[model samples]
Target: MFGYRGLTISDDGILEISGVRCDYLVEKYGTPLYVFNEEEILNRIKEIKENHIVKYGGVAAYASKAFLTKYMCRLIKREGLWLDVVSGGELYTAKSVDFPMENIIFHGNNKTYEELEMAVDFGVGRVVIDNFDEIDILEDILLKKKRSIDVQIRITPGIDGHTHDFIKTGQVDSKFGFPMHDESALHAVKRILNSPALKLKGIHAHIGSQLHQNNIYKLEVEVLAKFISSIKNLFDYEIEEINCGGGFGIYYTEGDKRLSISYFTDVIHKAVEECFSRYNLRKPTVFIEPGRWIVGEAGITLYRVGSIKDIRGIRKYVSVDGGMTDNIRTALYSAKYTAVPANKLNNKDEEQVTICGKCCESGDILIKDIKLPKLERGDIIAVLSTGAYNFSMASNYNRIPRPAVVMVNRGQDVLIVKRETYEDIIKNDL
Candidate 1:
């Protein structure tokens, strides 16, 4: 119910998404399916671009790691937002669609030489440098090619985010970027500035993922603004921009307090404005990357209930056809989600059941002890807020094929990603 814009309960008590009943989709496309609300995604993109980026005269890059397909890249391109790719495969996916290379920003903690060469060859808009070795490797490649590429220095601002430890990357002890409190950041700036093949355009920092506090982004702006001011005062050079890497949180359940896009943009904009004035320096353009926020709530996963195990005085386990293979967020990050009995929306009989996957592992539980309508065999279960990391992180673990992805709007369902076949799973094995 978090992203219930186009969702409605029919008079017969059937849950419908974008006017398409859940059972109808399951019958047509089969369960263990991924469905995205096309209208919701388009609206989120428009809101970010018009209400936030355009008003501030900055760039909005869609972090492809949240979700990426050739069609997804095309959609981001159609919206006129930049693409933020973290790996060679993502870059190739974008290139396959002929996504504007100049609107692409390449980022990674350990980028290979081939990836850097590919970025330079494709004339990528900017490369976010995370370490000193990357600087050396990039300079070597660019010098050999006699080409100059724009770059952004990713500095660790030492801000601890209130997210899972595995996703935190902005602290000083992290292995992501140059630490600002130490001399490493300054040395990196000097090294990049001296590289004849690199143009140091700006600085970049990302605290963590699924951040709910607006003050964190404000602090990021203040810290980055101070860094820019120091560079200007020390080297007498102006930083054109600062990419505050995206980690905006989204609501997956009723307990989540979602932050608006304007809350982020307005706070950071004011922080940048005030900080620049305080430091007596010119304001630089801002770049915000939002991946999950834009697409998280726009997607839902539909699965079919299979086996049920009842333990007296214990917990009732309801198994679904799909498990960690299709949605690994729960197993990987301990992420929480909400689900409903799509086929029995009006059923008054409710039970608290531990929804689990068909995986062989005991830790493959998707939702732990959730109240849902009494489930039965063949019941279609719709898991909400799965639009972000679910499909992108899907795997062929246990030889299970991934599910198909469909986009629905105004009652029309279009298949975007075809379900993986058993043959497709072994196609890569030699």
Candidate 2:
């Protein structure tokens, strides 16, 4: 089973991911914690490559924005996955770990002049061009260096990804990419073809994130293929590279067919190959940047039950020490997640209850109606399918310090990210 959703509690009343126990982790690391299974993340990379890329010749670019630490960057490199970094900090994280610079792709809609220069100066594998303004910046630097920067055009293919509205990037009305139908985008592509500072390697489009349907992805490929056909004469594009953005979904619970990356990739390969063959286009090196599917289920947020309050006849509230501060996907995107009692997993499930965070807002409910086991103070609850966005989006609201992160592997554990201290908190205070 994919390690993302396969967690079980031992007979000793200890919850474990794969073979790594959670009860001992909570005892040693304290509640309000994060635990990631190293094996799961690595397996996902292999699955993505074997199932999708081997057939399609696609490059699996691990989106480093999800939960980046030097250890994570190192892991991504060890697994032979390319990196997709959006900022100087993310690039720095990958660089410090000595991730292959030739395998790194820099992306951002509004990369600063300094950032753009640094990316080119670092000789990143590619810079995903998002807008006309970015072209100006790249030209300024690449011209000064008199070296063409390999790049991909981020285009909006007008296909809906059907995920949360906030995270959707493929829509024409979005700010992330250049509109595919626009003359401006075509002009930018033309300029890239004519320029000495920039090389137009391929076209890129991301339909959405946390996607559920594979058909939507097929539709996106069709659109991109048709457009590529249209521009073949003007730009003479031979389809050397084509990046279908990553938004492949994974199951948060039962019946959520976040189809396997392997399965999805094969289907994508067929789609792209068929389209390219039909249109007489040369085969291109396929590329996909997946952040969530690679790491989401591999992570779990461990929280300690602080109090259980029964609002007489209204509802019961199981409060945890950390809430929106650590996992804001529930509050910010109404993202659904599943939780199980770390020490009480086998107990009969009861009626629904709102799992509330210790945050100040009433909207900080982690799960609106989770039928979890009967709980008590000091109980540890592990929130699953949180590896992607939780820690990367953690906030310091109400001035509470963030939780620590630990990675478990082969029954051995190590503290990957240290807990933030109070003094560390005020260190930035002027």
Candidate 3:
């Protein structure tokens, strides 16, 4: 079980995360507040190590797409973990925090010319290349710069992860990576092997995210091992790394079940060790990118309940000050989330209400038919497990301002990301 340290749930049902009460955060930062637990984030990193670090010497990188800030980068970096950056903007953020270039692994299926050029110039440690086009792009850039770039070719591996189809990248039909059955993929491997300007270092594959089973990853490793082995035999070449890609799921709702980090580690370890021993394969350094599990449960989004209307013939609507503009998962993925009355902490459960966002779209529903204590205008509601995709995916829809993000550690709470103002929206406009 993932336990939240420095937090307590009072008998009155009030939730205090990292010594800072959710109610207090609402009062201080206003509605649509994002509260993060500093300790819990680190704890997740430790969980990965506890569960799997010993096997083939595993290393973990916090997937920045899950939610990123300079301080968040520093926190993860300080804990001695690597980072996975997907774009130039994310890479720029990592650089802003002075993240070590050697520890950053650049990942993207369609990296732009400028992004690739910038990464190479910046000297990023590893580039996780997705397609043959990208292979050509990187080689072109390296030839021009007269520099050799360390690269990892991403293979489809045909592993359809048990998650939303849109987010799964390992399936053959997906937009990411080279498909295994396609002869073009073998040609891609040979191309990388022959390219003197690009050093082909490894194979990368992401099974998917929000995954619930460890066996899925076990199968991924098994398949990846065979893929790498075949490449070695065919090309007489060897790479030194195997990036498993991160999609480890965190507990969202009470009914959600996730494997312990140790269990996840053991499964991968057994798979890798067995394969290498059986094939007499050379062991390569293992890398994983876990995003949500690190920060999802550590975050709580606090929103102030606005007006409440009971439509007798229809469903009751309790509008919040912010909505899909700030956290679009509900509207986008039909993603389910849990919420509680932050201000009415000690109150008993008394109402079933549909929590809607202030976004103009009716699809801006946050939680549908959520049970809560008797609600009042101005009361604050805290939504749990939003640390992953909320801020990273927030948009200016309805022209609403983005919410602030804060880190709560020990008894101190500090703002890490400030809420956007109306001026921020029109800054780029004429």
Candidate 4:
């Protein structure tokens, strides 16, 4: 099973997503292509909006760091959801499409002065201030521009999420937010409440990415609620919002436990309510910034098998046209994924092989020791659940041009991102 709602296997043993044949898309878009199911994406968006945001009266912001294109920004805006941008480039991408400025929230620990000025200029809804220097920078900018902006102070609640160390941002030792153990978070709050140019709205925290445990968010809400209650009592200020950064897990491999958006919403709502009731505080408006949950399963990457080298009693190396340049998760976080041969979806002729990228690096592996049908040259391979970070993190490693991206719905395909040309790789060269 593909573990996604949009996938289908044809009787002729080929793969189809949203009724569009994968082979047909490969023929038109070329190999190493990223295909997104628009219907599925919309469905996921509706799922979150109806089940999570509307149900609980919260704001859902799509984390643009996952896989943001101008079209994606438009899609999020069309759905009436907010957009989260961590850099000036992402902010500009959304602005280029005339997305609503008030629906954007700027986030980053070390936001540059230019990015802060841009956020201030655009009149973004909120800025999640991360550190002391950034507070100073934003205060100065707001004073000079004669603008007052709403902001939430990002706090480290000292809760360790069960995810990759690289992504665990809520721990006391993490570099992301002010730690609650010491006076740093408290000090930041005091400074923000005292600032004339910044309106201290609430607090924010992101535990980590790719999480499966339901209690993780419950724990996060507990820590955040306690901190918020104490701060509110200390400063006699109303906490109007609670921005819980999203990192909900998705199905990439069989090991992943499939959880629904409704389940995540239910647990978080209960936790937030219980914590608020315990602390004798009002339930502030909640905001969740989900990047991978809504888009991960809606995307699949198609790569062409180039060469197969079988070593006696050792391994079979099946190299594809793309590797770390397009998907570096395996090399970066040992992220696991499930892939199938698009041309032989139901084939029972299994063979053990390691799917590798064409990159020169030895660690540029895509999948390891997977049992699939005998793969041949030109066989189309579909790597599922790549919609989140694949294209967003792609690079020009080894000078391999990144692949094109297409969105499919109702048997219709539209190119969303053009395939990088050979010249595009060296365009910045002197």
Best by lDDT: 4
Give per-model TM-scores.
0.98, 0.96, 0.96, 0.98
Clashing pairs in 2: none
- Point out where model 3 deviates above 4 Å: 1-7, 10-13, 54-56
lDDT of 3 by residue, 1-430 (tens): 1243345766666678887777777778887888899878877787777765654478788899999999988987888888999999999999998899988999987899999999999999899878887888899999989999888888888888888867788888988888888676788888988898888888888888888888988888888888888887988886678888888877787778745676676787788888866776888888888888888888888888889999997778999888898888888778888887776667876878999988778798999997888888988888888899999999898788888989998778999999899999999998
Candidate models: Cα lDDT each: 0.91, 0.85, 0.84, 0.91
CA lDDT of 239 in candidate 2?
50
Query: Which pairs clash in model 3?
Result: 51-262, 246-289
Q: After TM-score superposition, what is the CA distance of residue 213 in candidate 4 from its true location, in Å?
A: 0.6
Model 1, 138-226: lDDT tens per residue?
Answer: 99999999999999999999999999998998899898989988889988998988789999999999999998888988899889988
Better of 1 and 2 by lDDT: 1
Cα RMSD to native, each candidate? 1.0, 1.7, 1.8, 0.9
What lDDT tens digits, residue by residue, belong to model 2 across residues 1-430?
3234557668877788868888888889887999998878877888887876675567889988888999999888888889999999899888888888999999898899999888887889999999988998899898889877789998888887788899898888989878976676788788788887888888888898988788887888888787778778666766578898888898787658767886667767788889988888877788989999989988999998988889888899999999999999988898998888888867886767789999889998998778877898988888888899898989889888988999887788899989988887889999
Estimate, for each residue in 59-166, the C-alpha lDDT of model 4 and write its tens digit.
899999999999999899899999999999999999999999899999998999999999999999999999999999999999998889999999988888898998
